[model samples]
Target: MKYTFYLKKTLSFFLFIPFLFFSCKKECKLSPAECHVYENSGSDCTKTKEKNAPVVASLKEIIHPISGSDPTLNMEELSAIGDYIGSAYFVGLGEATHGTREFFQMKDRLFRYLVQNHGFKVMGFEATWGGALYVNQYVLQGIGTAKKTVRKMKFWTWETEEVIALVEWMRAYNLAHPDEEPLQFYGFDMQSVDEEYFWIKDYLSDLDLDLFNSIDTLLKPYVSVADYQTYPSLSETRKNKFKADLVKAKKLFENKESNLVALSSQQEYDLIHQAFVIFIQNEDILDPKFGKGRDFYMARNSEWIRNYVQPRTKVALWAHNGHVTKGDFWAEGAELYEAHAGNYKVIGFSFSKGSFQAYQPKGVGLTTNNVVEEMDCQTVNALMADVGEDNYYIIFDELESTSAAYKYFHKKNPFFMLGSVFYPDSQNTFISLVNLPEHYDILIYFKESHFAKPY
Candidate 1:
């Protein structure tokens, strides 16, 4: 059950930052006004006809301190963020999967800032909930004794460094604050016994033993005591019916290919979805003692936030940038955040090279070692000329920009479009879905020039 790393490539240049470096190199500079475009823009400049347009408000941007300097945030900024402590916030890690030095450094800084300044006590991630609980329990018993055992276990689709670092951080935090309640780390993704069975095997040993015994009993009815090994053969009519049904189930499971290896993508998706649905509906058949399953977990997560954190504590979730982004797949019609309503504030953190350039107006003289551009309405197009022609840009007018349209189409929920499957509904069906309003209160986009570069 151990998690494995599939290293895609070596570290990139952007990920070369050292932990001790208090600030970034001055390779380039932009005016404070230029750096904070949304803040400076008046109503006329910021307003757009798009319903998904970002809601902006002025807040001071913190500049990283110089070499050997301690990072600091002004009181006003700290107070503003503190006010939303009980609310859920989804913070995106910039270039996290790349496992670069800068990514680690930024993550550490953000973690410390949130804990010390923002009063966050819980840290949830994209990891498996049961596996995380197991790791925490093992670490609490003793790291020296538990390290090897913990390494052997697997949970979610995450790198070893990511989970190890998170667990270590929690362990260290608990050690330092002995009197405080231990901070919780959990996962929210729907669970499957096939996926999580390894984590709960010890607890269900007796159940497994009983089920095997029952299966042995059930098999006796179809076999004779004298020749059980050869069992009873089905009559020709029964055999045909069995084969026909098996073929039907196979077709439903595989979707198209006559052979097993070439299943359609939709078939794979349906298989995964069905596995989740079964786990949610049949907890009694799987875990007799607990009688808890997928639906219970999902409801618990929503209830925990609504009843516990939403009332008294602020929580932040570290997940994929897509989940936290205001209109992305994880945010569309997300019921968790809607439960909190006005009490919660979600913010997204993303990086985009284009966003920096987008700040420059139609015409202006821009000079950098990378390129030089003269002011004009087509500045963005001219600046990106060196980039390959196939590099596509997300033009707002080219697609539906509102969250509702994006979610309704991409998630393929018939309810979203009044049960219609044609015209605008079908046409926009390819758009990405997002967890509705709970996604983000602010989005940070970090842009780079090459697609191969770390995002």
Candidate 2:
């Protein structure tokens, strides 16, 4: 019962996200106090713009235009930036906000380009490993429908029409390119272990009662691996025991012990076993001794994709800007960068002003509101807005030589951050000091943004 605008392309996968669940409400306006990140009067960092004026003026010249929603609109522009993708095992398409439509569209388009043009064969997400197994089967093979596979996921952000269209496109591309490398979907998160948990049970239900009982015995101690919700705090000793048991249980089928099982099926079971341990390890957040946090596990999962899961050397990663950027501030990205040496390249996202989906003190969808307030005069968003471009991409390498881009290179400064929450406490949401060019190899900016359509 809602009217949303949409367009269909030739062999295209673009679709407008439906906004059926919410009604328009009062326009959420912002005050001067909400814009500034600090108590200092110098929150208006516009004065520093004089030194960066030359780079600002050339913004339109250097940036690749990403106007409109069809990410494939301009092939020449997307191709021109291939050098930025470089010779890396991983090419990351990071978003500024998980709740922005443009972010999803452009990242999808970019990854699609990689699958079609580059030798990149794997498309990984920051989604649950268990959920992605179902999605992976559907996208690579024809096991299930696009909508159904995505709907089965625990994460709400990805359960949208846009994602469905992307998966469908991947399916068609896979069918068409049988001789060439097929497109595969993989998740590199410790989100949940239920799909793997249940799949193991059902898979062994027919063949080996001993294995089923073994898996059951391994799982009986825990309540629910699927929910991962509010479980009792586990001691390191208990965590280690579960980790060892899951590994031993998975090897029962793998390691050539069960020659009757398919290699693919065995591989899946083995991966699930390892991923389950990762899920348990990540539950601890960060390690007390080594400082190995969730990001470390995330980075390790990326390595697993290349080494164990996928045979391809080149892959496309989709996640938030924070997880992809290589720096000490973010453990996952830092670990990925360090693991790859100079082989890894990340593209980061930012927005000028527009409504985006985010949470408040508690639960609520994007709701109808212009939460995408104007940028702080002193921040990076304000600087890019001064460039007067609708949408574009700039190579950080080109700007690294300039003395004027010094502030961004040397020190941390205010940057746009619209996480899942951006209202009431919009002032307290995703405002972190970051060295943009340092954090990302390439930067994509939009003059305005719209909220991501929720399922």
Candidate 3:
């Protein structure tokens, strides 16, 4: 949720500026009063007498050791995850750092496992909703090359060789399952509106030229915003007018909903309506006066996908650990989804140390750097390292209540939560503190991480 990378370089950063300036600074230290209570709840972080002994012993028992993160490997080791998923509707797969090779590969691997075993039909990303539709076109219809489509999604974090591999795999899967419904890929985040706006104009133009012109004229003034730095300088009256125009656009969509659905499929009409909603969300989050953050709308956009866009289909969300955790930091929206969806499960990733790609400090551009070797006995990464497995995953809910691992999870621990931007020396600033049991249902840990190979 750090606004330092996406919009900082282009058009996506403005919406999350508030998050970078405000939420990113929040950290739960080893303070006595806040050591381990479940973030919103008052449950105590109980300590065990044996320190790491019992926890390590229990971890050794429950952890599912994997051969590697490679998706092509015999994935029989990942079969246990299906049992942990049970009947969950949404599986939020999170990455410790957006640019880690193994994390991306692991997610690509896990998603393949889920689709094959669990009948998961949809996958959503933390990307611009309208833009990712093209990627979906590549997956479902093979409309373009995977590398070019992935690059067009516009998030530098996702422009990687690992992701290209995933897209290629998805396309292959669809080809193999000729009789079945093909897998669906989409972006749930509503940070930018240019793609949505352009699509809407084209969609409406096909349906009704007058409607398209009216809506386009209403939205034209705001669409030219090329950067985040300029939006804050707009006068209040102008901002209010922009907000009003967005509402008018939505009303126009609503007034002709039945006709629109008649001309297009219900699904197409719904997508058009959602595009307007995203435009409003992009406007609201970027507006300095609005209190709602990008995560707030992101949660809603994700729900919209689950409930309407791809109704009755199991969805796997791909995002950063900060956006997926049910903990309080930048999780206001994820918490909302957990409450409403009820069957949501989050899987968080971690690494002991390595290098990752991130935008250079102050948003100069992309660079890869090794993380400083920082570790603490109380942190989750160190505890997982104590287990001595190069790669393993643990499902917290599967552990017995009396087990040392369960008690260890009950306590708050520092987690490696790097985003798309990094300051190697300022590790403490990005590593967040959270009760693992409350924030994530499953934890995947790798002993070392490497930078994602760029395509």
Candidate 4:
């Protein structure tokens, strides 16, 4: 039931994940790794500067205050961020809430700064690898409109004007740098594979119609019934058969790899091969015996990009804070950090308070509400809110070991976190205890959050 629930909730639709069963704030009993808090340690840090005066003062000394999140504005302040990244090969840019307009805009601004100043080449999203290939087509070749390309991503969280602006910016940058190395966009997730199937079918049909017929016949039965309950709910025997058929299809593709690559571009062959990989990922997600979650597979996909697909190329990944944190506990970025070690970095985002868009209970639509959770100084959100500026960025590695900010960040802090959905009035759902310094190497704090405008 745990596996089926996750499959139906994430793969079928509404794929915003890590749907943890949170404990009550009044008597929280969840483990420190899961709830991200130290038991009975809420008073470990000081609420006023009297007991922790050095911490606040240290934060002010090393913090770089930014003017605003507007990407079109002067970016001289953001140029300092590149110095912190140094030679890191992979950088994770995380959002506190998926529906924040300011966060989205700020990422756009930060990404532009990285591309223009640094030698970063690839931009990966927490989206489907197969669908993102189509988006890559539009950005590199002008094959489709920005709105249509983003919609192909199949996530309501990304169907926003803010995202579209970023996509168009990528295209514009590529066009302007015709002679230089153009930036490449990719998706590192494998949950949604509609676009994967389309590309695989198109490739097979064009080259080998008879082989295409056999594979399509096997896949046809499930196409019409691929709904929330119908697909992931398949019986054990049927699921095994489905996986066997996909394995056979992959073998068929592998046998013809040489001929396919000779006839078409290497890019085309790579697309179909990756599609088969995604099909296997889809099957594994449904099989409890696979013993892995989406985060593990997402980490593998991103690593594949850096190690296999584009070796030596630096990548900037965009995803939620939960997926991007590198804490000792569980997270996609944590997996990557373990594999890459000093070559990777995670930058976390945060907000004090304001209205932001979120999904309601059913599949109705998005709602905007102000979250008024009472946050004491023990939390990073409250501490950042007390800063002198409305916006600022901090690098944990830059702090002195004896600085108060270093000690404060090393302790447990209940950071405010939100996915794509939440109850209408449940502000407690947004609270999560996290060790800031361990989870993220850099931090960007916004004084207030604003709802992301949907396209």
Candidate 5:
């Protein structure tokens, strides 16, 4: 699968930096010591309500870096996160940007800790259900190559060495503990235009030829993204065709028709139907009135995985900050928080400044990575350095909304927001309004970071 480029259409300008460099730009050999966080109050940003709010004391103790990447080395710090997680069956690892190496590394390290220490039996990704199936097979059953299956997920930002390491490690863990239930991967993103067609083919692959053709014909318009790009007017046509086909798919998959082989599980059937739901509404997604329907479906799909699909009662979720943050913007994750009623805990990753990667699609068949240097600190991401650690976790649960710390964290600061696609030299790289305790239960802050190099 190719790197899907649908979500990078907008960006905030206040976070933009003057440097317009790409991946090959002069690499800085800056010292690790020099990278420690600093505050520049003069910069344009959301002034913290308690810029002087007494730095949290019980929470302010300096955090030490792990002796190495071995998550076991930092048991105390890792378990501290578990403290905030409480008894919630689900834990979310939300990243501020898609391509940060530290975010990826810490996520793998953190999840491993949870699985080993906390019994998080399954792990879910922010990928399409169809995209994640193959990787799940490879990791658990050893059915195919890990990297290639991950590539099939289509989100190039995550097709990295870091993820490959995480998958391989999970495989080893599963192999060592055959008697125990194995760790699994689950994808819950709203389907992009491509998977909607591919899933139809796969679902009907076991059907007789005539039946397959009849259904495929109705889905012909949205099969290739190039058609949409070349002929922008095809959106309405795509919507109509998908809606027509969706009716057929719903009828076929809903009833317990014993003869249905290719479309077996209600989960798989739901994925195909869900894809069409998002596909037909693509044109209206940008309209404020209609946009949230997309995110609403995202949360529903994920909650479906949690409530029905996975046998595991507990799970760990991985996704960019945009999808998982409790912000009012994305309805999918927000719906999850609403439905679970505090039964879920979200831990969002934040960064001050660093370069990260994105995909630039070269028409229909190809795409390339561009590591754009993140703009300067203007958000809560910047102020994190004051807590006095290279990396640390802040538990927001203790701060009530009426408290100075709470109001300060709620101010609209510009946090670094890059995902599957980004542009260097764009006016600003920030797309988030930093409301800390409200958006995430715990904030994992990385003062400085670098990009991930995918294998």
Candidate 6:
């Protein structure tokens, strides 16, 4: 009995020994400078700063500070950082406001550098599949009345003077290079009903026609015959009802509008958008397959880069900074690098300090002069004054943060839904308004704050 008790005690001691060993181990919390030195140069924590060494700023300083400024670098230093970057993604918050001259100048310089040194390919502002198709059409054929019609109706911001300039540049590039495919620009967005469904007749076969007709019949009763005949602009009540019904149908279908039976009329517009999503998600349904959305499109783009763009290609993805920002919805933060499979080195361009603040353009009774007043910040007026009016740009800021400022703005102006849809998750990940991921990259407080930026 004594021997057995001793053996049991020894076993307990062995088990406890491992636990104590692990418990006693200390985790070293290194400063950013120490982390940088250790990671980059294999330096120990006791080492002093070297002469002419790179200055390392703390992550806190970068995230929260009086002014989050870029490193003060001369042309040589700028060139060194530029050289380190292989491909760059520029996300414009909105259209250039009057006071953001410095921002634009830097962006322009970056563009020129990518073109001159990196052999960069430019992707433009079209976000829908049809818009991308139209761009390709324009590349093949010069701008004509057809192009203008598509631009006016389908494309949102193409009407902007700045975007027009970019389009003109693309046209000139195409004209100059009659043989080479003008720097490939394709939209990675889903098709909208108003833009592409009417054109389906041109692309669909007899089988597709039958399927579409069958779906239309299934969905016909949900939309009243009178709703079909009513002109969209006839009355506010009629328009609202039409939109409400569509929203209802969208909800009923579990956000799968396309899976439902289709019907004719403006009321059936929501169904069309749904069908597009379904079609893309299930590409096997189409006889001649084409992928849609960023997931498939970016995958294809990656292949294009590997094959054609690999040896010597620098590409600039001119997209919303929201998409490129660290915490953006599609590919931002650590997930972004993981999503890309580390094939492309991605850097986001953001406005460090400017007059730009995101507010709802629609629904709000806002003009260029009153935008700053609508925001939560008290220093907005001063910031606007500091930036000046001539060089600024206005961009549609998508505020995804769930802070007091965001909540206050949304609560006061509930009509400004800001293009978001809420759904419950098993993890209860989205607990409150704050649970949503922030959409903007870097808010460029533009020098002047009034210009209307792009979405």
Instruction: Give per-residue lDDT, candidate 6, residue 241.
Output: 49
Q: What stretches of model 6 exceed 4 Å from their correct place?
A: 1-82, 87-113, 122-126, 145-155, 205-315, 328-336, 345-367, 370-455
In order of appearance, the predictions have TM-scores of 0.43, 0.82, 0.85, 0.86, 0.76, 0.44
Give each prediction's root-mean-square deviation over alpha carbons.
Answer: 17.5, 6.9, 9.4, 8.8, 8.7, 23.6
lDDT of each: 0.33, 0.64, 0.74, 0.74, 0.61, 0.33
Write out the backbone clash pairs for model 3.
Answer: 7-12, 7-13
Name model 5 segments beyond 4 Å from true.
1-53, 56-72, 193-203, 207-210, 225-232, 235-238, 261-292, 359-378, 400-407, 421-432
Residue by residue across 39-87, what tens digits does model 2's lDDT show?
A: 2234535556775687576565566666655655766667756766766
lDDT of 2: 0.64
- Off-target runs (Cα >4 Å) in candidate 4 are 1-53, 222-228, 289-291, 307-309, 362-364, 373-377
Q: Write the per-residue lDDT of candidate 1 for residues 1-455, one digit (tens) a residue.
A: 12101000000100211112111123325532333211211223212312222211000112112121012323342333345443444333322122222233334445556776666665555444444444544434333423443333343123334345555666777668766544544444443233333332222233244432433342222212212122123444543443343234323433422332232222223322333333333332233333453333443353443233233444555544444333432341133445445544444332222211111133432211111111111112222222222222221212244533333223421111001011211222212333322344432222232111111
Candidate 1 total steric clashes: 35
Residue clash pairs of candidate 4: 36-433
By TM-score, the candidates rank as: 4, 3, 2, 5, 6, 1
lDDT of 4 by residue, 1-455 (tens): 11122122112211223222233364447543333222332464444546666677788998989888888877788766788788888999999888888899998898888888887877889998877876776777776788888888887888888888988998898788877666777888877667777877877877888878987876655444444456667787887788788788888888888888887656556656877887777667656565377788888888777654457878889999999889955688999999988888888998876656777665635655324333545567877877677999998888898887888888786787789876544455667778788889889998877778777
- Candidate 1's TM-score reads 0.43
Clashes of each: 35, 7, 2, 1, 4, 31
Best candidate (score: TM-score): 4
lDDT value, residue 84 of candidate 1: 44
